[model samples]
Target: MKPGIFKPLKLKPFRSLFGAQLFSDLGNWLDFIALQVIVAYHWGLDETAIASVIIVLGLPWVIIGPFASVFVDRLPKKAVMIVCLLLRIVFVGGLFYAPNLYILLLFVFLKGTVSALYDPARQSAIRMVVPDSMLPEAVTLSQLSVNTMKIAAPALGGGIIAVLGPKSPFLFEAAGFVVSIIFLLFLPSLTSFEESDNRMAETSTVKTSFWKEFSEGIKHIFHAPLLRISIILSSAAFFIIFLYDGLFIFIAKQIGFNEGNFGLLISAVGAGSVAGSLLLGQWTGWNRKPVHLMSSSAILSGTFIVAVGLGGLGFLNFPPLVWIIGACLLGLLGAGESVPYGYVLQSETPKQMMGRVSAAAMSLQTFSMLIAPAAGALLAKQLGASFVMIGAGLATTLLGSTMLMIIWKKSGSFQPIRGKQLDG
Candidate 1:
C-alpha cells in the first residue's frame, strides 16, 4: 500500500533537507515577486526592461549549468548548497539597497549563477538523503513545497509590498535563506552517503579530464533511450505550454476577467497542482508505469489548454468560473505529468551521475523558457493570442501521443525500469 504524504518526513535527513528546500524555494518566489514589483511599480520600468532582468536571471542556467554540474559532482553537496544559499542571501539582500537597475541586474546575475550550481547539488543530495524506494514520495513532497509557495508567495509578497514598500520582501527573502541554512546544517554529511556507495567511489576515481567527464554525461544521457526520449518529450511539452506564459493576461482580458479575477485564474493552477501532488503522494501505484502516466497527463493538460484557448476565443462562451475550472484541470494534469517524470529521472539515474543528468535536464527546460516567451509574442502578434495558445495545445497533444507510440513500439508494453532496462 502507498504511504501517506507525510511518510517521508519520518526520515530525519529528508526532513531537514525538505525543510531547507521549502524555505529556500519560498525565498526564491518572494525575491521574484519583489523584483517584478520593484521594476514595474517602484521604478516604472517598461516590459522590455523587466524582460531583460528575467533573461539575465536565467542566462546562467543555459550557459553554465553543465559546467557547474561538474563541480557539483566533485564537491560536497551539503557544503555546495550552503554556499549557494549564502551567496543568494548576500545578493538578494543587496537588492534592498540597489540604487538603480544596473546594480539590481548585476545582483540578479550573480544569484542566477549561484542558483545554477545550487540546483544540481540539491537534486543529487535528495537521492543521498532518502532511500531509493522513497524517491517519488520525496520528489512529490518537494514539489508540493514549491507549489505551496507558488500559491502563497505572490500574495504574501504583494501584501508585504503594499504594507512595507517594494524593498521589504527582499529582507524577508534574505531571512528565509538564513533559516534554510540552519535547517541544512542538521542533515548528514554528503561524504557519509558517498562513502557508503561503492559505485560512487568507482565512478569518482575514473580519472578523466573535466571536459571528458562532462562529455560523458551528455553521451550517457543521449545513449540511454528512456532518458533521451523522456527528456525530449518533457522539454518539448514545456516549450509548447510556456508559449502562453506572457499571453495569459491578454487572454484573461478577452475573457472579461478583471485583475483580481485573473489572479484567481493563475492561482487555480497552483491550487490544482497542490491537490494533484498530494493525491499522487498518497497513491503508490503510479510508479508502475511512469512513462505512460507522464504521457497521458501531458495529453490531458494539452486538451485543457485547448479548451481554455477556445473559450478565450469565444468558441465556448462559458461563465468565467468555468474557464477557471479548466485552468485548474490543466494544473492538475501538469502536476501529474511532472511528478512521474521527476521520479523516472531520479530513480533511473545512477547516484554518481545524478547531478550531471539533472543539470542537463534543467538546461533543456531553461532553454525552453528562454525562447518560449519570444516565440509566443511573435506568434501571437501574427496569428492572434488565442490562436497561438491553440497551436501550443495542438503541438503538445501531438508530441505526447507520438512519444507514447514510440515507447509502446519499443517495449511492446509499458514496462517499469528494472535492472539494466535502459543500458545502452
Candidate 2:
C-alpha cells in the first residue's frame, strides 16, 4: 500500500531532516556490522566478548536517557542533531586509524550517549515541522526508510567487507556521518517548538535544579492517566518482547541456520515492518485506539511468537522451507504490531510536553529491555531456544491483555482521542 513514489517530501525542514537521518542510519548499520566482524575475526574475540561490545553500545541509551530528555528540551533541536552527527563523525573517524577494540568500545559509548539526546530532539523537531494531517504519513515514510535500510544494509555491509575488508565499513560509516552532518548544516533553526509559557516563566525567573526538572517529568508521566497507561503498556511490551532480542541468534543456530540465514531472519522482520507501515499509512480512520490496542495486543503478541516457538519445535527435524515460512510469519506479526503503537503515542500525549514524555516512555521501555537480552540468553542457554520464545510470547500476550483491560475499564474504549476531536 505504499505510494508509487515517496509522497512528496514537501516540508523543507522535514526534507532536510529526513535526508540527514537516512544517511546516518545507513552508515550506522554499516559501522555496526563492520565493527562486530572486526572484533570477531580480526581480533579473535569470543561470542561473549562480541556481545559485550554490543552491550557497551546500548549502555549510554540506558544511563543517559532521562538527562538527555532535559537537555533535548533546552537546546535548539537542529543544533542538537548537528552536534551529535558531527561528534559521531569524529568518534567513528578515530576508529579508522586506532582500530582497537577498547577504543572502539569507548567511541561506541560516546556515540550512544549523544544519540540519546539527538533522538528526542529529532522527534520533537518532527512535531514542530510537520502538519498534523501529514504526521502519520511522515512517520510511515520515516519508518519505511529505517526498515528498508535495516533489511538492505547488512547485506551491503557484508558485500563491502568481502570486497574491501572490515575496516572498509567503518570508513564508509564515517563518510556517511559526514554526509549527514552536511545535510544537517543546511537545516533552518525555526523547525522546533518553543517552550510553554509556564516553562519559559520558570526558566526566566527561577534557575531550577536539573534533578527537579527530571523528577517533574517523571511525576507528570505517572500522574497523568493517559500517559500512565501508555508508559505501562509500552514497558510491558518491551519486557515481553525482550526475550526475542535475547534468543534470536540462539534460535537460528538451533534450527540449523548460519550467519547468513540469521541475517535473513532479522530482515524478514524488517520486511514485514515495511509492509505494516505501508498498510497503516494508507488506512487511517481509527475512532477507538484503546479497543484496537487491546484486541491487537493479545493477538499480535501471542500469535507469531507462538508460531515461532511452534516452528522451532521441529528444529531438530524441520526442512529449510518450514524455517523460511516461520521467519516470514514472525515478520508479519512484527509488522502488524508496530502500526498502532505510533498512534497511541501521538494521541495520548500533549504537544508541548511531548519531548519529556516521549523520553520518559522510552526510558521505561529501555529499562524493560535492559533485562531482555540477558534473560533471553540465559533462558536459551538453560532451557531451549523454543521454550524461551514461547515463554516470551505468552508473557507479552498476558501483559498486554492485562494493560488493555485496565485501559478499557478506565476509558470505556480503545480510542485515545474522540473522533470529533480528530476532525477538529
Candidate 3:
C-alpha cells in the first residue's frame, strides 16, 4: 500500500525541506505575477516588450541549467541550495528598485540562473533524507505543496500588488527567500551521502564532455522512434502553447478585466491542474492509447483557446466568471497532456538514461520558450492580438488532428525500442 501523504512530514529533515520548498514555490509565483503586472499595467509596455522580459527571465534556465545540472552531482547539495537562496534574495531585492525594465531583466536573469541549480539540489536533498520506500509519498506531499501553493500564491501575489504596489511582491519574495534559508539551515550537512565511494569508483574512468553526454542522450531518443516522435510532438505542443502563454495580461484586458482579476485567471488554472493530477493519479486508462488521450486533450485545449479568441474579438461575450471557468478547463486539458507524456517518456527510456533524456527534452522546450514568445508577440502586434489568438487556436487544433491521424496510419512504424543498442 502507498504510504499516507503526511507520513514524510513526520520526519525532521523532511519537514525542514518541505517548509523551504513551500516558501520557494510561493516566491516563484510572486516573482512571476509581480513582474507581469509591472510590465503590463504599471509601465504599460507593449506585447513585444512583455515577451522580451519573459524570454530574458527564461534564458538562464535554457542556457545555463543543462550544463549546471552535471555539477549538482559533484557539489554538496545543501551548500549549493543555501548559496542559491542567498543569491535569489539579492536578485529579488534588485528587482525592487530596478528603475527601468533593462535592469529588471538583468536581475531576473541572474535569479533564474541560481534557480536552475537550487531546484536540482533540493531534489537531491530529498533523496538523501527520505526512505526509498516512501519516496512516492514524499514526492506526492511535495507536489501537494506545489499545487496548493500554486493556487494560493498567484491570488496572494495579485492581492499584494493591488494593495502594496507592484514592487512589493518582490519584497515579499525576498522575505520568503530569507525564511526558506532559515529552514534550510536546519537540514543536516548531508555531505556526499550519495557519494561515489572508493570501492565502487572507477579510477580509470575519464569523464566525457557535456556535449558527448548530451549526444548519447540524443542517440537514445532517435533510436527509439516512439520516444523521439513523442518528445518532438510534446515540444511542438509546448511551443504552440507558450506562443500566447505570456500574454495573459493582454488576454485579460481583452476579456474586460483588469490586473486584479489576472490572478483569478491563473489561479483557476492551478485548481484545474490539481484536479487533473488527482484524476490521472487514479485513472489507469491513460497508459493505453496515450496518443489518443493527448490528442483529445489538445483538441479541448484548442477549443478553449478559440473561446478566448472569440472573447477577444467580442464574438463570445463571456462574463468574468465564465472566462475564469474556461481558463480552468484549459488548465485541466494541459495537465491531461503532460501526465500521459511523462508516462510515455518513462516507459520508453532506460533508467540510466533518464536524466540525459529529460535534459535533451528540456533543451527543446527551452528553445521554444526563447523563440515562440517573441514571435507570438510580434504577430500579436502586427496583426492584432485577437486574430493571432484565433490563428494559434486553429493551428493547435490542426496539429493535434494531423498528429493523431499520422499515428493511427503508421502505428507499425514505431517498434518496441529497447534492446542491445539501448543497453550499449
Choose the strongest candidate by TM-score: 1
State the lDDT of candidate 3 residue by residue for 1-424, as single tens digits.
2335467788888999999999999999889889989888989888666777777877776787767765654567778889999999989988888888899899988998888778766765665676544554565456656777788888799789889998899988988989999998998777545453111234344355545555666787888777776777788888888788766678779889887777788888888877775665555455556667778888778888988988888999978999888888887887677766665565565543444465556667778868887788789889877777877788778878877887889888665454433323
Cα lDDT, model 2, residue 28 = 76
Query: How many steric overlaps does candidate 1 have?
Result: 0
TM-scores vs. true structure, each candidate:
0.95, 0.87, 0.76
Tens digits of lDDT, candidate 1, 1-424: 4567788899998888999989888899999999998999899999998899888988999899888897788788999999999999889877888998999999999999999999888888887777767877998998899889999989999999999998999999999999999999998777977655423323445445567668867886776666677788788887887788899899888887898789999999899999899999998588877777888888777787787688779886878888888888888888888888788787777676778888988888889988898899999999999998888888888888888888888874334443653221
Measured on C-alpha atoms, candidate 1 has an lDDT of: 0.83
Please give the lDDT score at residue 54 for candidate 2.
75
Worst 10 residues of 1 by lDDT: 415-424
Report the error of model 1 at residue 162, Å: 0.6
**lDDT of each residue in 104-198, candidate 2, tens digit only:** 78878887777777777777777667666666667666776777788777989999999998788888887887888888787777533454312
- TM-score attained by model 3: 0.76
**Candidate 1: residue 390 lDDT (0-100):** 83
Model 1: per-residue Cα lDDT at residue 204: 48
lDDT of 3: 0.75
RMSD of 3: 4.7
Worst 10 residues of 2 by lDDT: 415-424
Q: Best by lDDT, which number?
A: 1
